[model samples]
Target: MSASGLPMRLRVPSDARFRPILLTMARRVAESVGFSAADAAAVGQELAARTDAVTRKAPLAETTPIDVTFDVANTNGAVFRVRARCGGSDLEVTRPLPLA
Candidate 1:
């Protein structure tokens, strides 16, 4: 992971069915990068919910794909940025994730 937090990417089909896989990846990445256990879990849970919400609202075709991009805004006190995009629709959420 980068200085602030997230440093990963996940791409999956644009269906709601893939949310669990995304959550698992988010949790593992957050924890591996030194986020506190609870914080990591929270981040994962929040991401999953947010992604699902976005998916539900988006008018995506079944063939379209979704992408989850994790990034840090800056090297110092950077916030974790989660961007989910599907079928040209997108949603962004940020978190000031805590260090372990």
Candidate 2:
């Protein structure tokens, strides 16, 4: 896929209720970039886990917004990255994408 639609950013409430939506969005982005179904799901899970850790360390207000960014890069290999930020806390997760 082209990079035109890349570098996407999403802002969602910090409530745990939004976790599923976040995970599904992460999975869909991974799949759009050629990740297998299982791999995409794994990526989503990893993002959720990392975000959880960050939020736990620095608790955010229920109405606080978490900004999630998704991007793809090609260096030695294709790589997908997800970054989540809330208040003063931030976390990033990366997964290698399968070569086409």
Candidate 3:
């Protein structure tokens, strides 16, 4: 586990089957960044929706590699960011974090 509130870079096959794993990781990262359980769950849901939207707009081959990066290292910052890139399409989502 990263002490810097979930700084992760993942390269996974662009398959819908991997969504659950991604979502789980997102939620865990959120929790590590001081989000309540409910908030973490919401983060996961939002991440999933954003990912789906990105894929829908620019579809990728199942075997294509998707790069997902979670940037929560700036725990003092006001927002957390998640970025996903696949098939030349990029999606970035930012969510506000609870104040310390």
Taking all chains together, each candidate's TM-score versus the true structure is: 0.76, 0.89, 0.80
Candidate 3 is scored at a TM of 0.80
lDDT of 3 at 75: 58
CA lDDT scores, all candidates in order: 0.73, 0.85, 0.78
lDDT, ranked from best to worst: 2, 3, 1
Candidate 2: tens digits of C-alpha lDDT, residues 8-78: 88999888898788899999999999899999999999988877777777778887888999988777777
Give candidate 1's error at residue 31 in angstroms: 1.3
Show where candidate 1 strays beyond 4 Å.
2-7
Backbone clashes for every candidate come to 0, 0, 0
Pairs that collide in candidate 3 are none
| lDDT at position 7, candidate 1 | 59
Residue 57 in candidate 3, Cα distance off native in Å: 2.6
Question: Which whole-number lDDT from 0 to 100 does residue 55 have in model 1?
Answer: 67
